[model samples]
Target: MNDTPGWASPGSAPSDGPDGKGQDSTGQNGDAQGAAPQDAVGQGPQWSKEQPPPAQWSAPSGSPGSSGSSGPGQTPPPPPPAPGQGWGGQAPGQGGWGQGPGGPGYGGWGAPPQGGGWGQGGWGGPPAAAKPGVIPLRPLGVGEILDGAVSTMRTYWRTVLGISLTVAVVTELLVVLLQGFFLNDSATTAALDDPDATPREVLNALGGLFIGTGVVLVVTLLGTIIATALLTTVTSRAVLGTSVTTGEAWRDARPQVLRLLGLTLLLPLIVAAVVFVGTVPGILVAVLGSSDGGIALAIIGGIAGFVVAIWLMIRFSLASPALMLEKQTIRKAMGRSSKLVRGSWWRVFGIQILATIITNIVSSIILIPFTFIAAAISGDGVGLLDSTGDSGWAFLIISGLGSVIGSTLTFPITAGVTVLLYIDQRIRREALDLELARAAGLQGYGTAPGATPGG
Candidate 1:
């Protein structure tokens, strides 16, 4: 009789148990590998080879044990080799430890062969190596991604919040400076009316505007890059419970800034180019046609331009994150983002649109009053009381103040969501949760010997 915990009686065929392992009738080798032979009652043969052998045992062809047919009076043949070895006396399959066809170890039913176990194929077959920091694409609920985003924020709130505020302040300052000099009513009115103004005067004014705007723009751009890089670095480290200094974050960010900037500029440029092309025909028709025809053509062109712009934006929405986090080039990152986001454009679009609306609404609430107060205090209100006096300067100052306030309020939300969305998508597509869990020091993560994180 088999003495194993889950084995069956002697003379019975092997039966599959709940765990998918086989059981012998004699209740012998019920352990994962199988049981040993028992002594015979009458001593005709100490052990009958005809009885079903342990799970590992194999018998030669034409042998009673190999035939799997037992008779009441017949003596059984000797058992075969151990369970993992095949009848040919070879290991089930070949590959490095934990590197197999199904991935690493025995996988689910019908699952492709993994690495690191018997019966698994080699690397030349399917990919069996599990990698770190990569995840598989799967359907994810909105709440789940949101939860992850919130978790990320909690983990890296210091860096994310600080950088966001810094970027917001810098951006606000730039906007204020630009509005103060160029977007003022005095500048606009003067430019429009001074048709005979000296070219030098016009050039000087334009130069001031351009130089000021350019300087501010450069600062804003740098701030944005710094904010995004720091946020990504902090979030990733926090999720892993690892500490990273600002210097380390900058190091990681500096190398990818060019690619990120290229991607950023390219996406908008492509959209603008498409919109320009779409509108060109309409513009041409409007210039050379009757009023009604021109209006119709212009309307049609505008609609087409809007649709194409939306489509292009959706196609490349995830590129920024891919470029920054994966250290990929602009083209490759765009391609990777496009591939990963396949069939999920609408979801991403909805999230982005919602975030935009929310940020805008919040900013409006805070800035609207500030604008009114600034305009009232800046002498602009005097124009409303007395039409003879020009309040253009006052209007400029008021607008600048409002702009500064608005940008300051809105920057954090915008930057935070953008970075968070990128991380969320990666988690959904790459089984990033498991990788992150392992990184965060969770037990059982990468605990399996030879198991890689991203595989």
Candidate 2:
């Protein structure tokens, strides 16, 4: 036997058992070879005798095993390692011999090998960026808002009805009592026309009428402010699904009364001032002009007045709600409301204008017939046909009754739209829907108050 390992001969068989290192003439290992050879230095048919064939290793063609005698278990020996390289450095899925980070060796196959950090094909990629101006409106419809108002009234009908009726009745009663005892219009014009009337006498009578009317107006103004503030408070609480007693609503709104009154007074005064200011130049131009110039000046004044009116209306539209709900000072509340409506001026204007028209039409339809009946029953309807007209009491009674009826019928729609508009703007600008949802007892999906969404 050759002193060299039995692997020297290309035709030598591998071992099958413990210590026998050589192949027999038939190219088969003796039963004494331990196991199949695995390491490259142990190659040869005798090496094979020490080790069973690799389970699935296949030999390349044109190698030493090209002979037909090689069994399927036999495979060609792997190529030698490269210089300065180790067994583990080979790239995956290449042949059994190549250079790699670890050194020359068989490499695994699949995805590229990753470094240890997150970005190196790992699980911690950068988060997605948020898109802008993509916030969605809550699922609210006009009918739903209207229904909420009706529901609120149903829930607190006593307070709303009582306050509203009290205002209407008191307003009408005072108007009647004033017209009856104080400024009788028919007698005033007769007194004004009297030839014997002195200037001082005339001035005294005029002052009395002015003071009486002013007192009535102040009473009406107070009633309006109190009623509106309370109504707004209840409406806001109701829409938010929160409970509000009449007393609580009234109490909460008490501190805001002066602010709201100032707002109410200031808004109209500002509008009137604008109209007065804008019309001054136009009126002067008209007074000093020919027909064409006068027409032009009048047209200019009208346009300016219209624009200022719309601006004032939009500016103060949310002021009352701001006062009642936010308890903001008059100037600050107006500023805040103006800020809230900055980008949505047109929408707010349109909704308010539409609501106003609808409320007016509905109120008119309900009250007009009553007004005619009151007029006819009080003789103003017949006095229009009679030349000796004494319809002062008749006119007062009819107008007072009409106003009371009209205000009662229109109160809910007006108050509802105002509160809804305030809430809508907050929803749009502040993401108030989530807060509302949470307030309504919804969970898992609703937003918390003052918590920024998707931050």
Cα lDDT, model 1, residue 394: 56
Global lDDT of each candidate: 0.55, 0.60
TM-score of each: 0.57, 0.60
Estimate, for each residue in 139-160, the C-alpha lDDT of model 2 and write its tens digit: 3455655665667677767777
lDDT of 1 at 294: 69
Q: Write the residue-wise lDDT of candidate 1 on 1-455 in tens digits.
A: 43332222321321122543332333232221222222223432344435653444333323222123244323233333344542222255521122111111212122223333322332243323322222122234555444444555555556655666666666666665555445443553465358888887787668765776677676677666666666666655654556566678778788888877777778778887887787777778778876677677777887798798987787787777678778888999889878766777888888878877876887788778866765575654465432122344455455545655565545545554565566666665676656567555566654543333433
TM-score of 1: 0.57
For candidate 1, the 10 contiguous residues with the lowest summed lDDT are: 99-108
The numbered model that scores best in lDDT is 2
Q: After superposition, how far is residue 246 of candidate 1 from its true place, in Å?
A: 3.4
